[model samples]
Target chain A: MSAITLFGILDVLGTFVFGLSGAMVAIRRQLDIFGILVLAAATGVAGGIVRDLLLGDTPPAVFSTLRPLSAVCAAAVCAFFFGALIDRLKRPVMLFDAIGLGVFAVAGCEKALAHGLAAPGAILLGVITAIGGGMLRDMMATEVPRVLREEVYALAALAGAAIYVIALRLGLTETIAASAGVLLAVALRIASVRFGWQLPRAPGS
Target chain B: MSAITLFGILDVLGTFVFGLSGAMVAIRRQLDIFGILVLAAATGVAGGIVRDLLLGDTPPAVFSTLRPLSAVCAAAVCAFFFGALIDRLKRPVMLFDAIGLGVFAVAGCEKALAHGLAAPGAILLGVITAIGGGMLRDMMATEVPRVLREEVYALAALAGAAIYVIALRLGLTETIAASAGVLLAVALRIASVRFGWQLPRAPGS
Candidate 1:
């Protein structure tokens, strides 16, 4: 498959899992149907929108394209209906989230690079792309952002994106570089969770 | 003064007040100094950034310049130090916030229209510019967005933006159009607060 097609697939998958995560949060918060849908859409696309905005890509891909929106809707519906089932399968849910995070982190880096952003900008955008949606979701739920908490999540995405930036800078092919980045993110995230590795917190934060 | 200069001044002042609002929220939430600074910056600029991005303005004015950042810093410091004094000047604080809302709402509308957006998009963006920062601050504090609440806040800004859009469509000069929009927003907002006017909520929302 072409790189474009692969990225498209990755975007849809990421949106689906992210949407599921958002819907789960809304469900836990006891929000109404509209609230659940809002959270799902925000969680699925907010990061990309933020990355695009920062990079000056107008109208955003999520606005021009339909796949991300459809994926979000599908995820929200499935999540709402199978809330209990999903809750009982925490491991599967977490695995999906990690997959989404890894893919999005790489994609974000690539998109910023395509927009001619410098490495630092690209890396930061990549991390934002992975965590922005979830951060917004947490904010809406009146909870502390998981990113700002003790989780190693944002740093993992940052490392993954930085790898992609370096790989590309070193003349690696697009697909190979992206794959390397995504793999690092997924492995790091899953390992962190499994090993209970936590980022240090500020005193009394 | 030229319109450009006026707008520059307005943007700085708006950011300053918005930052103060954010710092206050963070302080009340018992966040540390870093959190206070983060919230202040986010609240001061997020709205304007959102407006610029949606309107296809890249790097956002805030990112390209130092004034907005400096204003946020100053406001955070003032809010942190003179917290009680600011609290005592409730009426003045409210008025400054109203001014910020009015100027930002009109600025948002004008920017979108300059970018070839239609009246509807311009109007919506205008309102977004007025309230985006506060909504973000609320989210960071883990509260529902004030815009989505039952308050008449966003509607007041909407009405102001819509007026600006209509006035410009009818061949009004930019100065007159903007002034009219600002006045309407400020008046409506203050009146709404004074009269306790609220947008009706859905059943059990």
Candidate 2:
């Protein structure tokens, strides 16, 4: 498959997972349908929107394209219909969220590289792009951002970005590099969650 | 006084009002001190940050200087001590917020014109810069953006931007043009609030 095609698929998958996670959180918070839809749409597209804006793109992808809107609608519909079932399957939700994080990290790194950013900046952008939506979601929910407080979130994105850059240096195929980077992120995130790994809090609180 | 000096004074005043408004909102929401401080800082500097970024200026004003930070601290202190007194005053809070909006709108238009943007784009950006902080604040609070629903909020900014552009076309003095623009915005906003003016809602539910 072409690299662009693969990236597009991964991007849509990431949006789906993000939307689902946001809807789940809204449901847990007992928000109404408007809140659910708002959170879902914001979480599904905010990271990419921020990334694009930083890259000097206009109007933002969420506003300019149908893909993101469709993804949010699909996720919201599924959540509306199977809300109870999804809530009961906590492990599955976490799994999907991890997968979304990984896909977003890889996609962000690629976009940054395409925009001609330096390696370190591209990696940082990748990490930001992967976690930005969740951060916004948490802030809107009046909670500490998951990436700031939870298990290896931004760290996983950073690691994946680094892996993608290293793979490029080794002249690996795009698909192989992308898949490897995403898998590395997912593995690290899942391990951190399962094993209760955490960064130390900043001192002087 | 030089035009730049006038603008500088307006910037300081706008920063103060922005910080005060943010601190007040935070207090009303019953956030802790840290939360209040964060919101104050975010609201005080966020508009300038957005303006700088959109203008393609590097190292946004918040990071480049101490003025914005100091303004935030000062506002936080005021809110911490005099919040009750300020809240007791019926119209002071709204009046101060209107001043901030007016100053920000003028500043945004001036900055956009300086950056060589066309008049229409400058006006649009002026409105964006004026309301960007409030949008961010509302989003963080999980509320519908006031600009999207409130009475003539963004429209006031748009009017100020348009007036500024027209004054420039007529070769008015910089200070006179800017002051007139700000006054127009403030007047429109206050009137809108007093009279309960609102745009027509979209047709149908």
Backbone clash pairs for candidate 2 read: none
What lDDT does the true structure give each of the candidates? 0.83, 0.81
* TM-score (2 decimals) of chain A in model 2: 0.93
Q: Which digits, one per residue and each the tens of the lDDT, describe model 2 over residues B48-84? A: 8877876777677789789879988898889989999
Over A94-201, each residue of candidate 1 has an lDDT whose tens digit, in order, gives 888888898899998888778766676577578878989988888777787766553468767978898888898899999889888988988888898899986432
DockQ scores for all predicted structures: 0.18, 0.07
Question: Model 1 chain A, poorest ten-residue lDDT window?
Answer: A196-205
> What is each model's TM-score for chain A?
0.95, 0.93
Give the candidate number with the greatest lDDT.
1
TM-scores, all candidates, are 0.62, 0.59
